[model samples]
Target chain A: MEAIILQILNGLDKGSAYALIALGLTLIFGTLGVVNFAHGALFMIGAFCAVTLQRLLNLSHEVIDDTKKDFLGNPLKVDVPYLADWFGADAAQTIIQWSVPLAILFSIPIMILVGISMERGLIKHFYKRPHADQILVTFGLAIVLQEIIKAFFGANPIPTPAPPAFTGSFDFGALIGMENIIYPYWRMVYFAFAMVVIAGVFAFLQFTTFGMVVRAGMADRETVGMLGINIDRRFTIMFAIAACVAGLAGVMYTPINSPNYHMGMDFLVISFVVVVVGGMGSLPGAVLAGFVLGILEAFASMNEVIDIVPGINQIIIYLVAIIVLLTRPRGLMGRKGVMEE
Target chain B: MLGLATKDFVLLLVVAVLCLFAPVLLNPFPETSDLAQFNAGYPDLMQRFVIFGIFAIGFNILFGLTGYLSFGHAAFLGVGSYSVVWMFKLLNYNIVPGLLLSLVVSGLFALAIGYVSLRRSGIYFSILTLAFAQMSFALAYSVLTPITNGETGLQVYGNDPQYLQGDSAPNIPHLFGMTMRATETVEFGPWLWQFNAGYYFCAVVMLIAFYLAIRIFRSPFGMMLRAVKSNQQRMRYTGLNPRPYTLAAFVISGMYAGLAGGLMASMDPLAGAERMQWTASGEVVLMTILGGTGTLIGPVLGAGLIKYLENILSKINDNILHQWFAFMPDGLEDFLVAIVHPFIGKGWHLTLGLVFMAVVIFLPGGLVEGGQRIGRLFGRKKPAEAEAKAAAKTPAE
Candidate 1:
């Protein structure tokens, strides 16, 4: 029972990411009607923003320390970072420790700019084109973006540590009267952070006037346009919001599984599957499917199943997708007339 | 009209003769020369020109004609490859059974996929196909590892039960009695040209495929596909269901991919999951689009151009750039070479991307349109002006 609960906990952070990305994808599809294949790349760019911030914070002037050479080293450099100079050594360490969360403030504006430019510059032209053309062009853009990232950052995964305060795990076995059951603190922190973000998004969408208007536009863009609501502008803003959401998810995800150029590619296909299984243009469906699939995947990875059927872990999610698609076609909450051609 | 067509046919025959003896005709130049590179009658490159030509030609039947873009056609190809490999593993190395099995298996898979995928049109269809393809890929990588051999792929084992033939002869796949890579090299001056047996076999198959494609293009079924492309609702209202025709086209295209896959494995005898990735499917689409989608011969040219460039561009390096730059004034040459260097060698994809963008933006009808434009430009005036003049001459009637 404890093991199952621990597995469920382990699945939540991943589930949160899947939900966040699928939510954004569905949001864009529901409103703009563009597939937005570059969403994954946008997520990647968001993580890189955190990496960029960390790099910027650590920028230093190198000084030769002749006295510090030891154990076959030629020379030692005692560097002083700009952050250390500005905030003093201990405070700079702390600031750098919390730089990932701090990056949200920095990444939001940058991602928004990127999102707006992407929509206005490239995607705007493709809106009237066939879905195949849209998919091809966006796929091309994704390849270009990934290659650019590779050229700059190389192919290796870069590790980003959580803050020093959240580096340990908490014992849950004692609480449950079981031995040797513990959950990582960072994971729990990740779950709370995800909830906060999700709640904030929900609140913004459900309560705010802008959110209400956006929802209204999603339901009937023609009516919104007829009302002189500038539906296009709101749709563009929604694209930015979607991009930022994916980006923020990436930023938070860095500590869980190091960031790399092709990390987005690894997730892109599965996320698309998630979106399809959820329902192409349904937000709540995406959220539900994400958690359900995440838990299913966790269970599938367990030792008991592999003994019965080898390599089930790799295929369980896809098998689930196929079954759902065959039965539901529109997915769990899909409405008619969306992809009916 | 008969006289004009006869004249064109004779001209075509003469061009074909020239193409057959191209290596001998262009022997004055080194094989590595740009002109020779274009004209070289090497069997390997020629084989590829035909094989991928067949693949793209088949793809255009479904995508270009029917406007149903499948992003998972490579799954059929992978299935074909695996089937052929399995045939080689179990039975004699004769390509007859392997090829037959490839076609049958891929066709069946396509039938299943098309049935479900055709249920949803547009993006939904595309996503469904993608999901199925990924499912196949995952299964091949993990669950079906015993059959596919997972990441390392399948290799030939000499000792096996000869299912059909008696003992003393080993059961291994072969084309009659000849080796797949059997080739004869001819030397002239400093150039060496190879005439590979397997390549000629592929060439013959490609010609047959081309002929079949032409037949399909002119058939009544092809007309129905075009109608479906124009407006499916109109077709449906006319008491004609487009599903069977589209599904047939899908299956035929899948068979073509399977044949290509079988040929690949026959030549190399390895099957892997990587070939079934979405990227491979996209590549065929790219080739079809780059050459000319709706045209019969355009896809062949597109496949040849991309494959040739892929092979050649990967060979360029900084040393090659430096050598070319050595003829100019030292500083000036270095600067110019530096500017061009990044776009070559390991950066071939950057050049390919720019070319793709150019093709998409300008030559939307692909190389076929580009050819017609050039022909018109030289014949009388600018192509656009000539087109206007032709439009005036023809009238609506």
Candidate 2:
């Protein structure tokens, strides 16, 4: 029982990420009707936003301290961050330590601009084009985006840490009257953050007039367009929101898996699977399927499962995908006629 | 001549001549010149150009005609390679049995995958194929380890049966007794040309593949494929089943990819799981698109161009860039090198990405159409009439 709980816990963080990215993919597909293959690249750019901010905070000049002496008996030199000089030293230390969370605020505007520009500049022209053309063009865009990132940050994974307060594992086992249930505080924080963002997106879409219009547009785009609503601009906003969701997912994800140039591509294939399994253009389905697949993946990786299947862990998701795709063509909760053609 | 219409026969003849004289034509530079680095006439590379040309050509048959953009074609390529290497392990180093076995194996694999994947169209189809390919890759690295040899890759082991081995047989991959790596170099007045046995073998196979592709393109079945691409529903409404034609195209293309894989192992008898990766599949797609999807000769040209760029552009390090711009002052030279550095060396992918996006954006019909446009632009002597004639000659699609 404890082992099962541990496995579920293990699955939550990864599942959260898949859910977040899949939600964004579904949102864009729902609103714009353009399959954004480069959405993964947007997730990647958000991770780099954290990396960029950390680098910005760490920018420093050399300082010589007369009080400290080196082995040569001369005044010792220290590197003082520009942040430390502006804010107090302790405050700057705290800020740098919390750069990952602070990056959430920093990434939002940047992600919005990227989202708007991507939809307007490139995807706007591809509306009437065939889905194959959209896929090919967006795929090309993804490669270009990843290559540009690789040029800037090199190919290595950069480890970004959580805030100092949330760095250690908390005793979940003790709290729940179960031993061996310790989990990282950061992971719990990430899961909570994901839930909050997903809820926020859902609530926004469910409650507001903007959301209503977008939903209407999604159902029958022509009717909404005929009603004098600038459905195109609302859809653009919807694209931006979706990009923001993917961006926030990336920002929080840096602490769990270090940001790398190819991290986007790595998650992309899995997230695509998630979206398909959830049923394209279905938001609730995306979340449920994401968590479900993630948990399934976790269970597959367990020693007991591996013992039975030999290498089930390596291919469980794809196996599930192939089975689902073959058996249920519309996916778990796909709308009628959506992507049917 | 071989049942081809006049224009196609002319195209075939031109390709035959080009293949026959490739070693001479590709090696434009003298042996000792600094420009020798740009020459792609070497056996290793020339073999790749033809092999990948075959890959893209087969891919074009399905993608160009049926408009099914498969993302997992490389899986079949990998399967073909494994089959060949297995044949090499059991039989002698003869490529004939292996090649034939590879074709059969990959065709079966494609039939299975295509039957399932063809139920869906557009993005779903692509994802399904990608999932299948990734699964194959993972399986090759794991459960298929016994057959694929896992991370170390599949290769010939001494303890293998080799039941057909004879005393006169060459140890390396060979056709009866002619070794694949055999290169006869001819040097004359500061110039050297290589005539490789393997290249000629691959060139012959490619010509055959090209001929087969052209015949298929002109056949009634090819017309049906085009109809499927243009409007599958309409065709179905006309009381014809599109599934069999599509499945056939998929299997044929799969056989093409498999043949390419077999030839690769024939050139160098090693098969790795990496051959089935998404990137490998993407490379074939890129070649098909960058050349021209529907046109017969486009994929070959694209494959050669991409391979050339990958080889030559990646070879240019900062020092070469500095040397090229040494005529400028120090700062300017340094700046030039710095500017050129990222797009070469380890940064070749960036250049490729930019070029790929540019092609997808501007040249939807690929290099063939681009060439036609350029030719029309230059031939200002009654451009309208010539343009109309050129348009008439192009496919009806």
User: For this target, which candidate reaches the highest DockQ against the unseen true structure?
Assistant: 2
Which candidate should be chosen as best, given lDDT against the real structure?
Answer: 2
Which regions in candidate 2 have their CA more than 4 angstroms from the true location?
Answer: B380-397
Report lDDT per candidate: 0.78, 0.90
Worst 10 residues of 2 chain A by lDDT: A129-138
**Predicted chain A of model 1: TM-score relative to the true chain A?**
0.95
- CA lDDT for candidate 1: 0.78
- Model 2 vs. true fold: TM: 0.97
State candidate 1's DockQ: 0.49
TM-score: which candidate is best?
A: 2
lDDT of 1 by residue, A1-341 (tens): 77687778777878888888888888889888988777888889888888888888878988777989857886788897888878899998889888887888889999999899988887888777777777767776776777667666767888888887777988878887886678777877877877777777778889999999998998888998999889899889989988889898888888888899877766777788788899888888888888888778777787887789777777777788878887898888887877657
**What docking grade does candidate 2 earn?**
medium
Residue A3, candidate 2: alpha-carbon lDDT: 86
DockQ of each: 0.49, 0.77
Write candidate 1's Cα lDDT for B1-397 as tens digits: 2222343334333434444554355344667664453453666666666678878988888887788888888999899899888888777777778889999999999999999888777876777788788878888988888888899987666674536544544344467766667778898666777767777677667766765765676678988988878899999999999999999999999999988888888777788999898778878888887777677666777888888777667677777777777889999988988788756666666566667656765676677677666766678665344323322321110
